[model samples]
Target chain A: MSVTAAKGFTAAGIAAGIKENGNPDLALVVNNGPRRAAAGVFTSNRVKAAPVLWSEQVLASGQVSAVVLNSGGANACTGPKGFQDTHATAEKAAEVLGRGAIEVAVCSTGLIGVLLPMDKLLPGVETAAAQLSEHGGEKAAIAIKTTDTVHKTAVAEGDGWTVGGMAKGAGMLAPGLATMLVVITTDADVDSAVLDEALRAATRVTFDRVDSDGCMSTNDTVLLLASGASGVTPEYGEFADAVKTVCADLARQLIGDAEGASKDIRIEVVGAATEDDAVEVGRSIARNNLLKCALHGEDPNWGRVLSAIGTTSAAFEPDQLNVAINGVWVCKNGGVGEDRDKVDMRYREVHIVADLAAGEATATIWTNDLTADYVHENSAYSS
Target chain B: MSVTAAKGFTAAGIAAGIKENGNPDLALVVNNGPRRAAAGVFTSNRVKAAPVLWSEQVLASGQVSAVVLNSGGANACTGPKGFQDTHATAEKAAEVLGRGAIEVAVCSTGLIGVLLPMDKLLPGVETAAAQLSEHGGEKAAIAIKTTDTVHKTAVAEGDGWTVGGMAKGAGMLAPGLATMLVVITTDADVDSAVLDEALRAATRVTFDRVDSDGCMSTNDTVLLLASGASGVTPEYGEFADAVKTVCADLARQLIGDAEGASKDIRIEVVGAATEDDAVEVGRSIARNNLLKCALHGEDPNWGRVLSAIGTTSAAFEPDQLNVAINGVWVCKNGGVGEDRDKVDMRYREVHIVADLAAGEATATIWTNDLTADYVHENSAYSS
Candidate 1:
C-alpha cells in the first residue's frame, strides 16, 4: 500500500490539531529515489493559498524530495503567517528527512485564512516520520481530505513497475479540474524530464476532465514522484498509459464521493471533429446541474442530456448526433430513438454516450449526479 | 400591459394543449411597423430546440413582423416533427395576420420532445388573434413559462418612447446565459440594422452574463421589436442603455425566482484588463456552488470567495485581488481584510465584488444562492 509501488516514495500521516475531530491532518511523502525529479500542477484559481505559492516556486527546480500537506486549516489569507507556516512545514520535513527544504512541497486545505499551530504541527510531523511505513498509503490519503467522505486510492501493476496514488476532494470538482489534492508514486525508472512530461499529459485528460460542482480549488496539487526502485525502465509511452489509468480510476472514485452524489456518471463524447471538441462538449454536459439532477432521479431524461450537449461549440449538427444512456439508444440523428425508460439510473454508476457525427475523436469525463443530499450537505457546511 | 404598447402591433394567448397544466399555451405578438426591422438571439446550446431552428433562420433576414410562441411542451428533440410544429405555428400566425410565415417569429417552452397538440392548436391561433389586446403583455409572458414561480416584466420610460419587456425562467441560469425567454418591445423609431447591432451588444453583456445553475437551455430566446409610434428615436447610445436596463432588471427578477432560491446574488468583477476578463472572473465565482451555498446560510464565507476567484485566468496578482461579501471587504489583496461579521447575507439579495487589480474593465453577473428547496425541487422533477 505504499507509494513506492508507483515509483520512489515513503508516506506518513499524523494528527496535527488542524481539525476539531482530531482526525489525522498532517501528511508527508518523500521521493527517496534515483533522482530528485518531480512535476507539480497547482490550482488555476487566481486566489491561491500560501502553500500553493511556496510549492509553485519549489517545483520550479523540478527537484522535489518531499511533500507536506495539512487539512482542516487552509493557511490561506493568513498573510505572512500563512507563508511562514508553509516554509516551516517544508523546513521541518527537510530537517527530518535530511534534504534541502527547496526540494519539499506544501499543500493545505479546509477552512481558509487560518493560522497553523506550529507547536502541534511540528511535533506531529516528527511522529509521522517515526511512524512512516511501507504500508502507510491509506492513512496518508485519509489525512489529506476535507469534506471527502471516503479515501480515494488506486494501484495499477504494470509489466515490471506499478502506479499507485491517492486523492481528496468533493463539491468543488469541475471540468477545468477538480478541487483535488493528488499524489502519485511510481517505482518505474523514469527521468525527471520524462516524469514532468508524462504527468502533465496524463492529467490533461484525466483529472482535468472531471467536473462535479464547477468550482476550482486554490490548493489543488497533483504530484508525480518516481522512485526507480523497480529496476524496470519502461518506455515513456507505457509509463504514461499506466499513469493515465491510475488517475482515471482515482478520479472516478473522487466523483463517487462527491457531495450528496448518488451516481458516479461517465459522459463519453465521441465522433467529434477533434479531441478538443469532444472534450469541450463532454465537459460542458458534465458540469450541467440540470442534467446531473435528471440523472440522480433515475428518470433517464435524455432531453436534458441533449440540451446540455447543445451548450458547447463542437460543430456538430444537433440532428446528426446520437445519444445512448446506460447502453440504451435513446436518441439518433437528434431525435428520440429508444424508450428512455429502458435505461435505469438506479445504480450508483451511470453511463451517457454521445456521438457527435463529426470525425473520429473521443473523451470521457467523470462526474456526479445532483441530489437533494448534495444541496443539504453543501448548504449546511458552515464556514 | 400588451406588447403592442410600442405601437403597430397586436398580441394574443390561447389554449393550445402544449402544457399539461392545461393553461393557455399559445401566444402571438405581431409588429405593425414603420420599419420591418427586428433582431433576435437564441440559445448557444449546440442541440437547439425545434423553434430555435426556425427562429435562427428567420432572424437572418432582420425583418420580422410577428412572433408565435407556445408554452407547456418545448417541441425540443421531437425531431422533424418539432421543426414542423414551429413552422406550422409561424405559418398559421402569418396567414391569419396576412403576411408570409417567414415574417413571423416562433418560440416555445415546457416539456421537451412531446408532440404539440396540433389538433387543437391550428384553430387556437384564430382564437388568440381575436383576443389580441393592448393589455395582453402579462398573458403572453405567462403563456411561455414552464417552471417559473412567477412571471416577470419591466417597463422603462424614455422622454419620447418606452421600453417594456417580460421574461420567464427560474433555474439553469449562468453567465453565458439563462434558460430564459424574453420579449422586449419599444416604440422608438429605430432601423432594423441598428436594432440588430444594439441588441447583440447589449445582450452579450447583460442577459448573457448570468449563471444561475450553470445549465444552458435549449430554448432560450430574446427578441426585440420596435414600432415607430413614438416618432421619437433617441440616440442609439441612449437606446442601448434603456434596453440594457430592462434586461438587467429582468435578469435580476429571474434570479429572484430561481428555483428554491431565497436570495438573489450579484457578482461584480472589476479592474480587469478587459471586459471579457471581468466577465470570465465574475462568472467563475458566481457559478461556484460552495460559495453560493455559504451565502445561502448567511455565513460570509470569504475563504470560498477568494478561492473561487483563484480559479480564473484574468491577469491579477493573487495578493492584489480584493473580494467583498455583501459590500464588506472581506479579503484584501487576496488575503483576509476587515471583519467578515460586518457582511450581512440575511437579506433576499447578496453582492460579491471581486477586484482583479489588472485594468479598468468591469462586469456583473446575477445568480441565486443554493438552497435545500432547490435540491428538493430538482431531484424529483423528472420523476
Candidate 2:
C-alpha cells in the first residue's frame, strides 16, 4: 500500500507509450475526500521542471483534488512550451476527474530538457482515471521510477488514521528535498496548515538529509494530501511523528536503491555547535568523493573524513575531532586510535560517527559510496 | 626546467625508503640567494598536515632558504607527534645547509594520517642536500609524484629574470590551491611583499580555479622564492604576468594528468554580475559529478549544466541562461538550441560556456571528466 493505503484515495498506473521500452509511465492519484487539504515542498534548484512550477501553484491554494504524474520527460528547460505542457496536463486531469484545474498537481520525471509526449500522456491520464483503484499505490510508485530498480512505499498508522507514501529516485540525489517525486496521503482529520508543518518538519530531517550523489536535481517535489476520511483528529505531535516515520522510511529506501550504489553510508555527526553545523559537516563528509571511494574499498580511511570536515566552517578544532567507522574508533583526538584492520566492513551498511566536540547538537546524512558502476550508469544514462 | 630554471636555486630528488617500494620520496630545493624574500599559499582546509603547519610559520618570516618535500606519507592528523616530525625535518634541512631553522620550509604528500619515518627522512634529506644541483629540477619534480603519470614543470622568462615551478598532484585536487605541492622560484630582484602580492594574484586565477576531483587535500602548499640573483627587476605587472603564465601551464598540466580522467573540461562562466558570481558558477559547474560523468561519456547533456548552475546562488535567471558545449549551442535561452548531434566531443579537451546573461564578468574553471578509472584508482589507493 502506498498513497492508496490511506482512506478515500484512488490511484492507477499505466503504460503511456512515453517510455520507449513500453514500461508503466503514467500514474494518477485522486483524493475522493471530504477534506482536500494539501501541502507540497519543491526542489530548491532554481531551474525547476515545468510540473514542479505548476504544482507549486496548485499546492498554494491549500488543496489538491488529484495528482497526475508521468515518467518519460522532465519538462525542464524547454522554455515556454514546457510550462504550457504542464498546464495542459493539469487541465486534462482536472477535466477527467471533474475537479478545478488549479486543484490538480502534475509531476513529471525522466530526462531533463525535454517536453512530455502530450498525446500519449493526456490519453493515458483518461485511462488511468477510469481504472483508478484503492490498491494501486504500488503501481503508482513503479510508474514514477527512472533508474530505480525497485518500488518504494511506506505506511504509518495513528489512533484511527493512517499515512502512506511512495517515492522514486535513483540518482541526482542531494538534498533540496532529495531530488525525487514523493506523494503522501493521510486519512486523518487535519488542516492544511498542520499538513504543511508536518511535511516540512518530516522532510527536513529525512529527505533533506539524504545526499546520495551530491547532485541536486531540477524536479524534486513532495506532496501531502489529507482526506479526513477517518474523522479522528490526532494530536499535532502524533500526526507529525507519523508523517516523519513514513518519510524516514521512504528516505532510507531511497538510499538503499540509489543508482549503482554498493555501500550505504550513514554519517552521524555529533557534538556540533548547532544542528546546522552538524548538517554542514555531515554533507561535506557525504559529498567527499575520495572518502566515498575509500569506504567502497573498505579501507577505513578516517583521514579522509577529517579532511572533509576540515573543509567546512563548522565549529570544531582539528585536533579535537574523533571518528569511528563500523563501531571501531579508527581515529581519536584527530590521530590514529584503534587499528583500522579491526573494523568490519564486510556488511553493505557502513556507519561513521564524527564527533566535533563543540556542542551537543547532532545530525546524520545518508549517502552511497562512489563506485565504478555509478560512473557507468550515469555516464550512459542520458544517451 | 623546473624550480632550478631560475639563477639562484639548486634541487635534488632521492629515494628515501619512506615508500615501501623504494620510489624517490624525497626532494630538496635550496636558494643560494643574495635575497631570500619569499611568499607561500596553503590549503584552506582546517585540518592541515604537520608540514603545512610548520611551513606556514617558516614563510611568516618572509624568507625561505630551503624547502624539503617528501612523498609516501602525508604527515597530517598525526597530532603533536606529526608536528614534531615536520619540525625535525625542517631542522635537519637547516642543519645540513648551515641555515636557520626558521628559514626552512617542509612539504609532504601521499597517504594521509601516517607519520613519516623520521629515521629514513632525515638521512634522505642529507643525501638530497649533498646531491643538490642546478640541473636537478626535473628529478625534484619527479620525486613529488604520487599517482601522477608524469612530472609537471613550467618556466617563463622576463626581460632578464625567469620564473620556474614544479607541481605534483593527481587526485584530491580542488581549490584550496588545487591540492598540490608547488615550488616556484624566481631570480628577479623582488621584495617579500611584492613576491607575496604577485604569487597571490597569479594563484587566484590560475591554481585556484583548477578543481580536478573536488577533494581538497590537507597538505596543499605552494611556495615562491625570489633570490634576486638575476639582478634585473622588471615591473610588477610583467613579473606577475610571467608568474600567472607559469601557474596557468602547471594548472592545465594538473587537469590533464588528473587521475583516470579521459577528458579535460574547461567551464567558462560569462555574463555574471560580479567576478565572484562568475567564479562561483564556474566552480559549481566544474564540481558537478553528473556533468563530469556525462562529459566522460561524450554526451552533450546541457541539462546537467543548467542543473549545476541552478544550484549556485549566482545572479542568473533560469530562463535567460545559455550553454554551449564545444562550439555548438546545445542550450540557448535556457532551452534547446542547436542540434546536440552537431557537437564534436571526441577530443581530450571539452569546452563548456555558460552565459548567465546577467552582467559582463567572466571566469573559467578547469576540471576533468569522471571516469570508471578514477573510481578504481581512488577506491583501492590505500589498500
Stretches of candidate 2 off by over 4 Å are none
* Whole-structure CA lDDT of model 2: 0.93
TM-score per model over all chains: 0.94, 0.99
Q: Give per-residue lDDT, candidate 1, residue B47.
A: 69
Q: Write the per-residue lDDT of candidate 2 for residues B120-152, one digit (tens) a residue.
A: 999999999999999999999999999999999
- Model 2 residue A275 CA deviation (Å) reads 0.4
Worst 10 residues of 1 chain B by lDDT: B1-10
Give the best candidate by lDDT: 2
TM-score of each model's chain B: 0.95, 0.99
